[model samples]
Every structure is written in structure tokens, then in C-alpha cells.
Target: MGIRSVMLPAAIAATLCAGGVARAEGLTVGFSQIGSESGWRAAETTVTRQEAKKNGDTVKIADAQQKQENQIKAIRSFIAQGVDGIFLAPVVATGWTQVLTEAKDAKIPVILLDRDIDPADKALYLTAVTSDSVHEGQVAGDWLVKAVGSKPCNVVEIEGTVGASVAANRKKGFDDAVAKDPNIKIIRSETGDFTRSQGKQVMESFIKSVGGKNICAVYAHNDDMMIGAIQAMKEAGLKPGQDILTVSVDSVPDMFKAMMAHEANATVELTPDMAGPAFQALNAYKKSGTVPPKWIETKSTLHTSQDSDLQQIYDEKKNLGY
Candidate 1:
């Protein structure tokens, strides 16, 4: 089914209604995305556009291609264009204060999507809509612990981009989880830069250094990296799900496909419908002069083989441009 044909969740539907047609209709918003870095990011962009259309609003998107400077320029452009609000998925956690101050000076309410910046200038933006990255990592790690039991396992980790808040929080959460289990240990850890090619390269080097037989499992920061690791294991003549248990965050459609094929063990979902809640908050703010909470947390659902309708989930997500 197409994205438009898919039914909105009851809560989201209620949120849309709560905004009221009169308050949300014809509102112009600018969205600055951090480029299509992975399937999950692409889904977020797609869902943002879909939500905007559903609410009778127009969204002008600027793809920053994973650069903070580009995002800053986009925000300035949005300010010059006199948009009602701006949605930003920052590429990094710093250097946003001045540009956000400009947006604030222009009287544009800025909403952060998926990522956040330094808190020193938190007042500049209206609110941040994002999932708890630490929680997502904890979910993945907890699943791995349960699946491995008391067996001694050597795990390899494929991390996200260096210095990214998501990467740091995820690493911290997984470390906190595994710290409880002395039998489970991570032997190799390296950055994949959140790209499939880089993930594959890092995994290849890991396989060479540790040898596939010595490695017990692989934990990636995201599904794209996990998918890349799966390919590396296959090429090295290792059964991914059997010989080396696989787990990661971001329950994208491709990860579901891997799970169905028994190439992956588990994944934690980072929902893409951030814009729905953002628009709801924007509408409420515009209608009643009410200020929303500084942070709005989205769900972090976990998916594994036990889920009966993997194919159905895949079908739904595939149409969302994932």
C-alpha cells in the first residue's frame, strides 16, 4: 500500500484532529534533513512529507547532505523566506546556537527532529521530537544478553559516526547493559560512519583481525551497519544468524527481511513519524500560545523473530520509501 493509503495510528489521528483543521491548514514549514544517510533517515523524510500533506500544510525540505554548515545555511534561507516554523535534524550536536538565535530573532518557532544540539541555547527552539537513543541501545543489548544466555561470547561492535550524540548514547546504553553480564564481552569496536560501505569495510577488518570462528556476535549501531556486517559474514563463509548472532537498532524494512531469512536476530525501531507530533505541537502553540515541553519522546519498539507478521511489516515499510 502507498503511504497515503496506510491508516494513521489512533493516537496520531487524534493528534491531527486535536490540532483542528482551521489551525493547521495552509501553514508553511521548512524542514532541514541530514540527508538520506540510511533507510531509516529516508523513511523519516518520507513520513515528514506525508504528515505535512495530511495536515493541509506545505513543507519545503532542504537536504544538508550531512553537513552542519549546509543546515545552517538552510535555516537562514528558511528565515529569509519567512516560514512559519522550521524543523531541523541537526548533523551534529554543536555549532547551532548562532543560527538558532537568528531563527529566534526572526520569530520563527524551530522544532528539532530526531537529533538535538547543545542545551546552552535550548530556549532558541520550541521543542525536540526524537526517540531515546540510549533506550534503543538498551533494548538491543538486553535482547542479545537473553539470547546468548550464560555462554561466553565475544562480540564485535560497528558504531555510528564519530562524535554523534546518537552513537555516544547508544554505546553507553549497550555498555551499561553488557556490564552486568561478565560472560559477554565486546572485543572489537570501530566507527562505521553510519554508511553501508564503511560498515562493510570495518567488518571485513574485524573478521581478519579476530577471525570469524572466534567471534560470537555482532552489534551495530543501526540496521544499515548490521546489514553490511551480514554481507561480510556471508562472504567470509559464516552463517550470520547461526554462527554469529546479529542485532542492531532501527527496525527498517530491510532488517525485517534479514530477520525473515534468519540472517539477523533483533532490532529496535526508531519511528519515522516525528513530524506528526511536531505538527501537533506547532498547531497547539499557534492556536493557544501554549509552549510545549522542551522534549517530546517517540516510541522505541523492538522487533525480533517472534513477531509473526514480518512480511506484513516489511510490506508496510517498503512503501514509505525505506
Candidate 2:
């Protein structure tokens, strides 16, 4: 069978159990989420949970609270429980080999959702479902360059978790774009851990140290941090979008609201609806005992005030439980 048409092994388990005696429609699946740190993350959880129900599958979810050890423990527990399959949105890429190997040895296929691992190894996961993170960063960078024009701007980067795929790729894309323009200087950069609270705290330091007057722009890896940074700027008596331009990824409804309110300048959309396609793939695999592509790339877009599709997309996402 072609890889593109392959399916997850759990879907196969759903069938071939005579009279549904061995495996019921309530096939238990394990999901380890990256915690409810952002709107995008919340939407992902809502959609995945709803999809599992719609497909008559029972999902056991573990919220990692942004801790790698917690996620590993959850995955191991799922393995002990002998779940049909397991899915994890890894907190960071490295240090996952051992746990993944345990899952593999337990005969429970693993799926990577909405994040990626560095030093890619095929043995760790059957497939990964996520967006082109680097592309998102490049889009954000391109927009900033055009908006800033030929002006020499000092930038402060608010990175995500230290080693997450989104953080690494987004920063890489931003750096690549900034490199083309020698006038764009990154005066400060630090990991915000993809949390709103952390974003605010880190931006506080930047504001106190740089005085916000000399800073040209703030680039955040995700919208949550951007919002937090905006709050910090407000507290410092500095206007966010006006005094210092702001750019971020994840076009969540909150970000859109921020853009409409003029707190955020622009955002790149990273939709949170992987459930439908994931379920479809599972169905195909269960019926055919085949595998799907090693990686499935989702669509993304740039959201600016000039775009008419914002309200419609935002409305749709809100309905999807974002």
C-alpha cells in the first residue's frame, strides 16, 4: 500500500475483532497535550477530543503543564494501560528517544501532533501531523521587513520553549529574513516558554532595561506571548502597536481581537483542526492495515487588518471550540 494512503494501526485494531467482542467502538487512545498555555493549544485539545468522540473512540488526555517529565510519565502510564495508540505533542524535541522507544517496545504506535523533534529519527514515531513551522516564521519576517521598509530597526525577539520545533524553526526563519536587512538588529532575545505569563515577565525586563523608546519592534513566536508583552508595554506607559510594532504567529481569535483593537500588528494563522484528518487517516488504516505519509503538512495564512477573511475564519474557529 502507498504511504499516502496508509492508516494508523489502531484503526486496524478497531476491526478484525469478531462480533466486536475483543475491541469495542470505545477503543481507548491516549493523548498527552502541551497544556493549556495558549488559545491555539486549547483549540487543538478541543478539536482532538471532539473528533475522538465523533469517531466513537475513548480518549484519555494528560495535561503536561509544560513539563517534559510529566508528559513522559503520562506516556508511560498510557503504555502500562495498554492503550490502542498514543499521541503526544512533545514539550521539546530532545530527550524523547527513551520514552518513545518504550512505547515502541510496548507495541503501542506513537503519533506526534502539532510539534516536531530535532535530530529526526524514523524509529521514534510513525508519523507527524503539524504545520510547516519554518514557513510561519518566514511569513512573519517577510511582513515585518515590508512594514518596516528600509528603516534601521532594533528588534527584540521573544522565543518560545528552548528547543521546541516551533521555537527553533520560527527563530531560524526570522533570523534568515532579518539577515537580509543589515539594519535590523536584535538587541535582546529570550525564551518565553510559550506562556503568556512568562512573556509578560520577560518583556518587563526588556522594557526596564531598554526603556522601550529605543526598541523598534517585538517579535513573538506565538500570540500568547505577544499579548503578554503588550500588557507589559502598557504597564510601562508605552504604546504597544504604535510606539513599537508587534508581530507574532498563531492567528487565534484572541490575536484577531488584539489586531482589531490595534494591540497587535499582524499574525500568521496556524489552524487547530487536526482531528478530522487524523480520524480519516485512522479509518483508512483500520480498513487496510496500511500506513499514511510520514508527515502531513497543514495549511496556514497571514492575518492582517486588510484581509477580509479574518472574521469568517475567526468565527469558524470559535465554533470549533477555540
Candidate 3:
């Protein structure tokens, strides 16, 4: 991975030490969430809050509830409270400069989780922790290519939110991999906002417009959308995994159930362990005056129908909300 580095001034370093555990309640953190929209997102919030409770750290939790303005308001409030650190799951990559700049001017170290901000001003924030979205997308695309072999395929894509890094990077990775295989063509593509209802609605339209036989597969940015598409296929009197090849990111329980039932082919894993590493970084930076790289890429896994371990994890994790 390429380096995305940020440097803190020595003068600020001295101030950082002054606001140590005694002053900030031993690593008080302010966390801003995008929203509990999908299973993966819910898992992320659940894991983060649980980790904070386990550590007995004072964490101010703010739910943006899928609104960028709400996220901005919560962050500014965290800044006002003089929290030791800040964590932001930005709604949109752009338009974050003002709020991030506010944190910087206040000398508060900021950690980005999940999504990322525009790289035009790298010094405005501390670092980010997120999945390698491009790689995850490529995994899905590659799996589809191998499964279908050289057969001509027509595919429809259900995209996530626009302008988000996950949406952009995942799309780029999938397109790059699919481009290598000339026989596969994307017949239709639309945004589902990473929600089940939206995914189902989009699939309904695709089925009506192109009919079931024309589409060989469905590539959704997340599992929720894929699940929605699967329902639409069933209602249209078409099989999902068998009649139309399906692949997506996020190995939620429903996807596993679909895989077991032979309605969904495969999914790449997105773990809720994101907060553990972020908090570890924050603790290290605070206690020892250590600064991490600007970008910390989280790990992911690809699960096919053959992986028993995936099925186990899926079954266990599904019941627990994120």
C-alpha cells in the first residue's frame, strides 16, 4: 500500500501531552456515525460502542441518522465539549473541509472511520481506518468471471450512495476486473443507497425492462441490495443464484442463508472490528506520543459457497445487531 502520511507540529505535540488522561478522562472519544442504515453499518456501531464500554472509556456517541448536516452538528458539538479525540464517519467525502478544519484549528486529533474525505488537504485530519474497498469489489467481479467462464453475460449493478469512497472504490475495482472479461456486459446499473427496499425496487424495474433471461447476473455494492434483488427475481418467476449469477460485498447473515439456499453465489467480508484498531491507534498516540500513518487499510475476506467457516460466522453474527 502507498503511504498517506500526516505530520503534527512539535509545538502541538507539547500541548497534546498536557491534555493527558487526567484532563480528558483517560482518552475520551467523540464518535460520529453515518447512520444505522444497513446490517454492516449497524454492526460497526454495535462493535464500537461495545468496545468503548469494555474499556470503560467515556465515549460520546452521536448518530447522524443518514444526514450529513447531523454529522456535522454532532462533530462540532464534540469539539465544543473539548473531547480528547474525535471519530467521524463522514456522510459525503466532499463538504467536510469546514468541519474537519474546525477540529484541526481546535488542536483536536481526528480519526476517520469507514468513509474518507477529499485528499486535497491532507493535513486537516489525523488518519483513517477502512476496508480496501477496491480489492473487495475486484474479488466479487473475479468470482463472477470464473463461475461463468467465457459465457456471454448481461449484468445489472445496484450501487451504493454516490460520492462515498466505498461506492466509488468498489465500483472502480469491479469494473476493472470485469473489463478484463469481454464477454461480460453491464446491461443496467442504478443506485440502491445500500438498502434492501431500494435494491428490490431497482431490481423490479430491471426485470420489467430487460426481462429475466437477458440478465445473466446481478452485482450489488452490498448484501442488502443483493437480497432485495433476489426477492424480485423470485417474484418474477426466476431463480436467483441459479438463473442469474449474483455477487456482492458484505457477508451479512442473509447472504449466507441465500448462499446455503443457492440464491446467492458469493460475498466479500466487511468486519465490524474496525473500531478495535482505531481505538488502539488512538490509545497509542495519546499515551506514547506516537503518530500512525494517515491511512490504515482494514482487512477483508472473500467467501464462496464452499467456506464452512463463513457459514458459521454468518450464523453467529446475524442474530447480533452491529
Off by over 4 Å in 3: 1-26, 37-39, 53-56, 65-82, 92-107, 119-121, 161-168, 191-193, 204-211, 319-322
Tens-place lDDT per residue, model 2, 101-151, is 999898777878888776346877777788988888888888889889999
TM-score of each prediction: 0.80, 0.70, 0.77
Least lDDT summed over 10 consecutive residues: which range in candidate 1? 16-25
On TM-score, the leading prediction is: 1
lDDT of 3 by residue, 1-322 (tens): 1232223454454465455435535578899998888667888888887777777676778999989999999988777667878988888878888888899898888999987888579988888998888999998899988988989999899999887668888899999999999999998989999889999999999999998899999999999999999999999999998899899998888888889888888898887767877888888888897998999988878887766776687667776583
Q: After superposition, which runs of candidate 1 have C-alpha atoms over 4 Å from their true positions?
A: 1-26, 37-39, 65-77, 80-82, 92-99, 204-211
What is the lDDT ranking, best to worst?
A: 1, 3, 2
Query: Global lDDT of each model?
Result: 0.89, 0.83, 0.85
Query: Which residue pairs overlap in candidate 3's backbone?
Result: 42-322, 43-322, 46-322
- Give the clash total for candidate 2: 5
Taking every candidate in turn, the Cα RMSD to the unseen true structure, in Å, is 10.1, 8.4, 8.7
| Model 2: residue 36 alpha-carbon error in angstroms | 4.9
Candidate number that wins on lDDT, 1 or 2: 1
